[model samples]
Target: MVFSKQVESPITTEFFIDEPTRAKIEYQNGKALMARGPQALHEHVVFHMEKALGRALPQMEVRFKDVSISADITVKDEMNLML
Candidate 1:
């Protein structure tokens, strides 16, 4: 996936999905976050993680707040919250 940011402002973040299992986050701080080859559950929890932070991050820099998981996608991935 590709990401670009503008040269101004309070900071806007956008996410994209490709290959179904890969996720990307583009932040206004000239940062691009990518998490590739995640299981279905990893995708779900990461979505929620972004949401949870979005709600409380009016004054924080979200680029540093981004989180990611491992590339391994096994049953253990689900057991570890990839589900």
Candidate 2:
């Protein structure tokens, strides 16, 4: 999901199940979710594109159901913008 072409929509806290240490997140249609798996490669690409054009997405909150860890994150290509 590439969101480096427009402004980001306001995102709020998200709820997920299980630990997300190695889990990968995919965003689409203004929705964010954590998949079960490692995302080192995906992160490598995204992190590298931090300075690229159209890469400024909105920030969202992440919470674990297992009480492991939580933090604020930005989701790319994960929001529907109006006007």
Reference-based lDDT, residue 59, model 2: 63
Candidate 1 per-residue lDDT over residues 44-80, each given as its tens digit: 4555565677642233454645677669654555557
Misplaced by over 4 Å in model 2 are 1-37, 54-56, 62-83
Tens digits of per-residue lDDT, candidate 2, 1-83, equal 22322333455332222223434555563234324334544453444465474454346667578566689997657365555
Of the candidates shown, which would achieve the greatest TM-score relative to the real structure?
1
lDDT of 1 at 67: 75
TM-score of 1: 0.22
Error of 1 at 70 (Å): 21
Model 1 poorest 10 in a row by lDDT:
29-38
